[model samples]
Target: MDNHEFESESYEEVEEDDVGHDESPQVITIVTTLPSARSHRLRTRLSLPDSGYEIDNVQSTVSANMLKILKKTFSIPNNVFLHLSQDNDLPSFPPEDKVTFCSDFFRFGVRLPLHSFINRVLCHYKLAPSQLCPNGWRILVGTLTLFRSMYNDDHSLAEFQYLNCLKASVCSRWYYFHPRPNVSKFILDLPDNNKNWKQKWFLISGSWGGELREDGVVRSVPTHFGIPGLIFVLYVHTCSSYASLHV
Candidate 1:
C-alpha cells in the first residue's frame, strides 16, 4: 500500500515508561496491522534513551503511525511483519499463506522462528538506523541486501535459481526430497571451458562444507545435525575442480 493511505487510525501507541529525565523520552510501544487484507500484525517498541535508540517487541494495536513510518522509510510490503517472541521452535514447514524473503542463502518465512529473524534485522538496523524504522523496515532492508547479493552472481539465472531452490530445500525442515541426484547432475553439467565455474563452485561448496579432490571425487562434510540430506555441494565442488583443470 502507498504511504499516503496510512492514516492515524491504523496503529496504537502505548507509553510503557514515564519520562523520568529531560533527555530520555518515554518508552513508547506501537502496535498495528499491515494495510493489505493479508497483512499480518506488528509491534514496535521505541525507546529513546540518553545514550541511543532501541527497539523492542512486536505487539497489537489499531493506529498506522508505525506502519506509515515503516512504509515511508523502508518501503516494506504488507507480507512482512515483525515477530519479537523468544521462541526458537519452528513448524515442519512454513504455512501455506506465509510470505518469504531469503537472505544469506536462508529462506526466512513469516512462519520461521522469530529469534533468528529478529537478530538479522537488528544487525542491519545497527548499521543504518536512519534508513529503517521501529517497524519491519530493518527486516525488509536486510532481506533486500541478501536478494541483491544473490542476483550479483555471474552465473546464469537458471543456475542461480537452482542454487536458491537447493538451499531452501536443504534448510527447511519440511522439504523432503532427494537433492543429491539433482545436485550431482547440475554440477556435472557446468561448462568445463569456463574458468569462472571454479569460483562459483567454491562459493557453493564452502557454504555447505563440501569438498572436491584433484581426482574429481566429491565428498560431503560432517554437520552437527548429522549427514546433510542435500549433497548438491559435493557436485558443485567437483564441477568447480573440473572446470579449473580443464580451463
Candidate 2:
C-alpha cells in the first residue's frame, strides 16, 4: 500500500485523562490472496498495532512490504540492499540482511552510521512508513540507542500477547501446542512475587544437537525458532523467572 492510501482513511481522536498512552499509529493492513480461478474472496484484513506487535511480527503485510522495499532498493550501488542481492564477492560489506545486528548486539560486526542503522533496523522490523514522524522517530531512536548499550549477546525476538484472562487460549493456539499444566504454576512461582507480572517462557526444545566446542563444555543452539520466536521466548522466560521466585 502507498502512503496516500494509508492517509485517506479516517481515525477518531481518542481522549486521554492523566496517564500517557501509546502513540504509535494504528494501521489496517489488508492482505489480498493472489487471485486464482476458484478464489472468490478478494482479500483479508489485519489490523496491526505498533506498540506490542512490531513490523516483523506479522507475516503477511510486513513481509510483503519488506519484499517490496527490498526489490526497489536492491539495485542501489554500494548500499546494503545491493550487497544482500549480489551473488559474487564484493569489496564492500554485504547488505544489512546478511548481518545479525539486533537490540542485543549494538556495535557488532556491522559499523552502520546512526541514521543508516536506524533506517535499516526500521526496515528489518517493517515499521510503518509514518513512523518517520517526530514522536515515532524519537521512540525509534531511543529503542535503537538502548539496543546499542545492551550488546551482551544476540537480541532475541519474542511475540508477547497483551495480558488478559484469555491469554492462555491465545498462546495455546498461537504456538500450535497444548497448554502445559505448569504454565499456571510457573506464573504463580514468579520471582519476588511480582504480581504485576512480566513475561512467560515458551518451553521449546528440538533438533539442534548439543555439541562440545574446542573446550569440553557443551552448548546447544536451538534450531526451531528464529530471531522472532527467540525474542518472544526470552521475554516469557524473563518474566516467568521473576514470577516463579514469589511462588
Candidate 3:
C-alpha cells in the first residue's frame, strides 16, 4: 500500500461542522410500518420516518462498499493485483464475508472529507486486495491515520481476529473460541454464560435505534434486515486507576 493512499484527515482539511463530535452519526426514524425489501426498488425506500433505527448500527451495504474499495485499491499498484490473483497470501484483513463492527467504531451515512475518511480507516485494521501476504505485511486503515509502511508483527497478526469481531461469521463470532463477542449471548471471561447460544440468539432482524446528530447533519444511510443480531457491550476494568495515552 502506498503512503499517499491514506491521508491524515484532521478537522483542518475538512470543513468543520459547527456541532459536537458525539453528534457525528446519522439516524433515521421510521414512523409507519416498513415495507418489505424488494429487488426493484431503490434502497432509499427503506428509510422510514417516525419508527426509528440506527442505520449505522447494523450494516447492509458497508461490507460491499468496503470490500469494493479494498479490491480496487489492491488493483491500483502495478502487478499487485496480478500477483494476488494467484494466492490469498494477501489475506482479506477481516476475511469474513459479513460485517462485525458496531456503531462504537464506524458511522453510516455520515459524509466526511476524503482525507478524513482515509485517516479514520488507517487508525486500525489491515486492508488487502483480498489476501494477507506471506510476510504478514498489509496496509493498516487508521481508525481516525496510518503511516502505511506495511509493518507486520506475527504476534499481533495472530491476535487480529481476537480483538476484532469482524473476523468471523456471525454464528461463530460468539463461540467459546472467539476472543470477543459482539452479541449479548456471550460474555468475556465467562465462557459458561455463552453455552447453547445458538438456541438463544434470535433473528428478529428488526429494531434499529435512531440518532439525530447533534451536528445537525442528516444522511440517508441504507440498511437491511438480513443479518439480524444484537449488540452487547462488555467493559473490563482491572484497576481503579485511569490513564490516558496520546498518539
Candidate 4:
C-alpha cells in the first residue's frame, strides 16, 4: 500500500440510543487497530452518544461509561484496556478514568494528548495492574514474573499457552501488553531502594521467562516471537501519537 492510500474496515453497530437522558449526546471518534494475523488495520470512527466525560484545568478524565459505548461500537470487552496510542505508556483499563489514573507512564513522564483515542489501541487485559508493574514480595509471595497464567479460565488452555511448563494453575493471571523493544540484547529498569523495587530485575516474557543473574547474564528465555519480523515491525511502527497534550 502507498503512504497516502487508505484502507477501510467495517465495524459493528452500536445499540439504539435510549430516549430517557436529558443531556444531549456527545461523540468520541476513535481510530485504532486490532492484533491479528494480517497486516491491515481494523478501524472505525465511533460517535459516543452521552458518553460521560470530564475536563478540568489540569486533566481530562473520561467516564467509565465510555467503555460500554466502545465495546458496543467495536464488539470488544467493556473491561479491555485502552491505550493512548503510545505503546510505551501504560494503558487505561476499567474502574479508572483514562487520564487521571496513577500509572507508571505518569511516573515516567509519559503524557496524554488530546484526542487520545486517535490511533489508540484497544487491549484485552488478563492480569492486574500491580502484577503488570510489580511492588516487591518476591520470595514470600513470589516474584511477579511475566509467564502466562492466562485468565481464559480453562486450565488446559492456559497450560497450552505456557507450553505446559510454567502456567499450570498458577496463582497469577496472564496479561497482554504489546511487544516492547530490546528483549534479547539489552535494557534494564535498574531497581533502586524501596522506591521501585528492592532486588535486581527478574526478566519475564511469554511462556518462557527467567530470573536475571546479578552478573548480567542472559538467563531469561525467549519470548513467543524472537527478533524476527515482529521486532522489525515494532521498530518500524513505533508511533508518535501519544506525544503531548493539546492545549
* lDDT by residue (tens digit), candidate 4, 108-182: 322222111110111111112223222111210111121213242222222221221111111222212211222
Least accurate 10 contiguous residues by lDDT in model 1 = 197-206
Model 2 C-alpha lDDT per residue in residues 1-247, reported as the tens digit of each score? 1223323101111123211223332222233333368843243323334223232232211233543443354321233321112122111111112321121112122122234444333333332221122332333444345555765332222100111011111121111111123232112221222221111111111221122232454432222222111122211122124211100
Q: Model 2 clash tally? A: 20
- Kindly give the stretch of ten consecutive residues in candidate 3 with the minimal lDDT sum: 83-92
Task: Give all candidate RMSDs, comma-separated.
Answer: 25.1, 21.2, 22.4, 21.3
Instruction: Give the runs in model 3 whose Cα sits over 4 Å from its true position.
Output: 1-165, 170-193, 201-208, 212-214, 218-247
- Stretches of candidate 1 exceeding 4 Å from the true structure: 1-73, 79-92, 99-155, 159-247
- Per-residue CA lDDT of model 3 for 168-236, tens digit only, reads 122221111222345232222322332221221111011111112325663211122211122112121
- Candidate 4 structure lDDT: 0.23
Compared with the true structure, the alpha-carbon lDDT of candidate 1 equals 0.24
Candidate 4 segments exceeding 4 Å error: 1-100, 114-131, 134-183, 189-247
Q: Which number leads on TM-score?
A: 4
The TM-scores, one per candidate, come to 0.18, 0.18, 0.18, 0.19
Query: RMSD to the native, candidate 1?
Result: 25.1
